[model samples]
Target: MINGSGFEWQESVSQLINVLQRSDFAASFLNSIKAISDFDSAVIMAYGVGPTPKILHDQLDDEYKDAFYDRYLKGAFILSPLYQSYKNNANGFFHINDAAPEGFFDSEYHQKYYCYSGLIDQVFYLKQFGAGVAIVVSLARTRKLPPFSRLEKMALKSIESIIISLVAKNWEKLANDEYKFCDYLNKAFENFGRSVLSKREKDAVNCMLRGSSSKSAAREMGISTETERSYRKTIYNKLNVCSHSEIYHLFFKSLEFADRGEDCDPLSLLWHSAKISH
Candidate 1:
């Protein structure tokens, strides 16, 4: 049986059923999770083919909203393993650490951007609607709070099907065609290093963007750490940027180039554009 405040199964189902096809579904669903567990906050995001995910609901405190909406929704999400799961059409339950690539915590992703956003740990309940769309309910515990325990995870897993079904039924009309956006982050990230980098090099660049160290990046790519080091070195030489911060600046600079509406390598465009002519 699920734990925490000890919500009975029948009572939980009734509460959920009442909220179906209603705006309160997300809130009720989160409340049910809280009734059964100890998480502090939750966000329901509708993701589709693009990087832009609509925030269907969030019970975030005022303190965390800036990072959650301002930075996370903008583009940093591309580096998220959760986003990777969505892209790969993943379903079911996952603790951030369980599904994340090894050495995820060591990376400067700022705890995959949560370091900056201020979440210590997270769990997800994802339900993919089709080839092109899904909903991810990201449950989090803030700083100073311990992450969910193994027992809690097991309890959540046991009820995963029920959680997914309720969420899916409620948001039944969601579709990828309905997911749309024209944002600089999406365009810039998609085209950032595509021109100057080879396919393998692009993979390396992605790892770097995710803040994976050479050893971890190599481990994920199934290459030696030395080879990963070489890839990073080569990328630095190819891009003429000495540090991660410079690469980031290049990424930001590319957003300006991306504004021109072409999906070409923003780095190449940034260097060659008349706008930057001195």
Candidate 2:
């Protein structure tokens, strides 16, 4: 049965399959949930797979969403009792604001502020497939809600199963590819830690490649020479490449993207672009 959401359950499951086959992994996750749940917002936090654990994809108020992201970066949620509860009870899902374990949803911090952020109730599923340690996938609503219906619970389980299968197969290669890119980046930028370059340095490099000069680049970017010099120093330090030519080589022809997951490809880029645009 389709209910009022426009698609029947069978068509919704088919939609999930289509989403899984698409290049953007996040889209698949969200589509799976929309197949069964009705909520004003959704967020997915991915951990142990990236340089940082962050909201992989979300549909929420932009400013509030940014605040949540900032909070995640600060590791507040990572250390929360709610997260701990999710870790303890793996695989099965739960309601975050419900009668969770003692000291779990009893966070003084959450009640004081985040409760008003429309993040009151949530359903979470924990899985530990590729990374070994558990990774939590949460679907939340700003408003309070009843527990997931039996059908909704089953749908969440199905989505988790699909995620487990896909990640176990591709995660190691994805990790390796990220490592390779980071290694190459480090090798290319090895010299920047020593001497900081001036604005003249950056302008010299950027302009040389693109027919821009320090003055022109500064004018275009609307910054003072001194500020430009500061950027140059930071770029030089981070990239470790002293000369413009080295940075050019590092970015241009020498760059490589192999062993990349399907989600890292051009089609994924297009999908994300489309999502962000809309």
Cα lDDT listed for each candidate: 0.77, 0.47
In TM-score terms, which candidate is top? 1
What's the lDDT for residue 117 in model 1? 73
TM-score of 2: 0.48
Please, what are the lDDT tens digits per residue for candidate 2 over residues 59-103?
777646665665544333433444445334455455554424333
Stretches of candidate 2 off by over 4 Å are 1-7, 85-89, 97-100, 133-135, 144-278
Ten consecutive residues with minimal summed lDDT in candidate 1?
A: 1-10
Which residue pairs overlap in candidate 1's backbone? 109-113
Q: After superposition, how far is residue 24 of candidate 2 from its true place, in Å?
A: 4.0
Clashing pairs in 2: 118-142, 189-239, 189-240, 190-240, 191-240, 192-237, 192-240, 198-229, 199-229, 207-212
Residue 75, model 1, lDDT = 68
Off by over 4 Å in 1: 1-9, 49-51, 176-187, 256-262, 273-277
